[model samples]
Target: GAIVWVHASQPVQLGSGEALEQRYDRRPGGPRIHSFQVDGGPNRLIEALDKLPGVIAVPRLGTVEEDLAALVRRLTSGDPAPAVVRVRQGAGGAERSSEDRTAPHLARLWALQQTQELRAKRQVRDAVELAGRFQLVTPVSGAVVLENQQQYDAAGLTPVDPQTVPSIPEPGTWALLLLGGAMLWFGRRRRPR
Candidate 1:
């Protein structure tokens, strides 16, 4: 028999309508089956997963390592997790008051959930550190530094100032100035000795 590795971060719940079973695999690389007669909501599942070491329980959409770390810190400090859990009993008839009281319980459960999340984050950080030590990758284009006058001169590249306003000559401005200078020079040269 071929052994297949499953790398999912969630536990699969089995059964249908009114009869549900929550399964947890505690043994390393082993199959597991669990059946219980209790309300197994997300909070309950998260609480259970938190008890298992190396088990990281993330939401369906997933969360970042930083956020998970912060959650862990808060949970370790006896602070409540910042997650809201809503439990509803029945479809449209009288709602059960017991379900309404589960909110505070959910908050407590979140703290436990964060413990597993934190462990997973630590594992990821350790793995990253280990991998970085084994390989050193450098930029192919090399370092980029601010181009100073010395650097530009060395590289033979001309740098222009874009803020400079070019001085424009008036219509026949240069010609008029040159003509005036010539008249003055001729008058001076032709002066009686």
Candidate 2:
């Protein structure tokens, strides 16, 4: 049997902040229509994310860690208001928006994904390191054998000599033994009894 530990987070206040989500709709021959769905109230940051001029205008951190940290800070900011935002795309590509803002739910989801990614990388690194230390066979670790005695000598490594061991007799040998035993039994029966 094994023990397990589980932790549950506090429930998010449903009416406190607006739930923000983006949707893209494409009809059979219609232009792609992009829209945002807000639950509670209008959010300035959400608007800014949507109408920001170009990709350069949208704000971003240098690294995923930095982005996650920023999201954490926002969630802990203590303002109990719902916000909505959209990402604006420009002709060239996804244009930058004025602010580097993200929906809390979206940010939370992204952070969770990033955490999993980091964990997987760490596990792989640890596994590789362990395999290297113990000389264990893994995807990135393998064994190489010297081709012959000369190769072993050149590398200053002694090769274990092959050992001689007894093995089972062939089928013909078994047949010959059975034949001899039958003949001996028959001869004894005729001469003595």
| Candidate 2: residue 125 lDDT (0-100) | 64
* Top candidate (TM-score): 1
Off by over 4 Å in 2: 1-119, 122-126, 147-193
lDDT of 1: 0.41
Residue-by-residue lDDT tens digits, candidate 1, 14-53: 4231221122222333332212212224433434444444
What TM-score fits each model? 0.18, 0.16
> For model 2, where is the 10-residue window of minimal lDDT?
1-10
lDDT of 2 by residue, 18-52 (tens): 22212111112222212222123444443433321
lDDT at residue 2 of model 1 (Cα atoms) = 14
Q: Each prediction's Cα RMSD?
A: 30.7, 29.1
